[model samples]
Target: MDTEMTSEGVAFAKQMLADDHAAEAMGIRLVRAGIGSATLAMAVTASMVNGHRMTHGGFVFALADTAFAVACNSYGRTTVASGGAITYLESTALGDELIAEAVERTRRGRSGVYDVTVRRGDDVVAEFRGNSREVRPRA
Candidate 1:
């Protein structure tokens, strides 16, 4: 949690922020990034709402997944999610600023596990767990 990121980690995070068009399009912003952890945030917009007027689950999931991706790749090796799962605890309304915090749970060789907690203020919104594998450098 307090571990400082190495030079490689900083470079990797910068590359990711520059390349992540999907997250940028969703208005996701990098709140913090460090070794094996990352925090991201996005505001729920009217277009992100579902039929119930709550923010869509997919958007919440995407935010969590993005955080996971950032954390897992903080080591600087190209990594990709092997799988992930999420549970929704509460709904979010328009203008709600949602935050997702991801931390490394366990890592073995090329594989890693990350836990992401999504929150709207102090209210828990969702929980996500992602499994990742370090792949080769991107071409």
Candidate 2:
């Protein structure tokens, strides 16, 4: 695990999370972050449960997506997800503590690829892949 993170990257991630009302509302906490990696944790709440009594897939995807966003943007560049997909492998219920860990797979020029795994304890719940594009600053 290459955990070499620049000081600016850490500062930027902290500031980004501060301004992210959606992440804040979901109780997502930043476990750790590096240059191209980040880990986040969220508890499955009652509101996140679906009609089937399992945690909603959307909520799981959101958690993974947020982790992916933080990881891609940790390079001190303005990166946005061009596309993302998730595969849910297990079901979770309310009160489950879910952790999403993201790592950069590759980066070239203005594009990057990242993988995130959502887990409940030692059980893998979902896997997510995200494609990212760095936004150029307007001159």
Candidate 3:
């Protein structure tokens, strides 16, 4: 719904999509990307389950983290996560579609924070917070 990203920003996102083999391997799909926000979705597969037969927290975290990465880097600056954490609130089963929405919380100088909420339909499944730092290109 928000359309504030520049054409170059969109191109940058596409480039990321083309090169992100890890995310693609997990079946993560990009839904939308804006200046400081992004939405991605993935489905829980049998390989992604834990001993309890529920989706692994790491996989969910990966989904949210990918969204956070895309959102933070959507502005076209090469960025990397300084740190990140996730809190799981619900469990999902195989074939369940999960969506992660990342939004920029704040940006100061070369550092920024983002919040990613993972959901199963309308239910909240997990929450992620990521700290990012923009890395300058060499002169």
lDDT for residue 100 in candidate 2, whole number 0-100: 97
Residue 42 accuracy (lDDT) in model 1:
96
lDDT of 3 at 121: 95
Global local distance difference test of model 2: 0.90
Write model 1 residue lDDT over 40-108, tens digit each, in one string: 899999889999999999999999999999999898888999999999999999999999999999999
Query: Residue 105 of model 3: what lDDT?
Result: 98
Candidate 2 per-residue lDDT over residues 1-139, each given as its tens digit = 3334567976686677767899988999888888888999999999999999999999999999999989998877788899999999999999999999999999999999999999999999999999999998457
Q: How well does candidate 2 score on lDDT at residue 108?
A: 98
lDDT of 1 at 103: 98
Clashing pairs in 2: none
Residue 11 in model 2: lDDT? 65
- Candidate number achieving the greatest TM-score relative to the actual structure: 1
Q: TM-score: which is higher, 2 or 3?
A: 2
Model 3 lDDT at residue 117: 98
Clash pairs (backbone) in predicted model 3? none
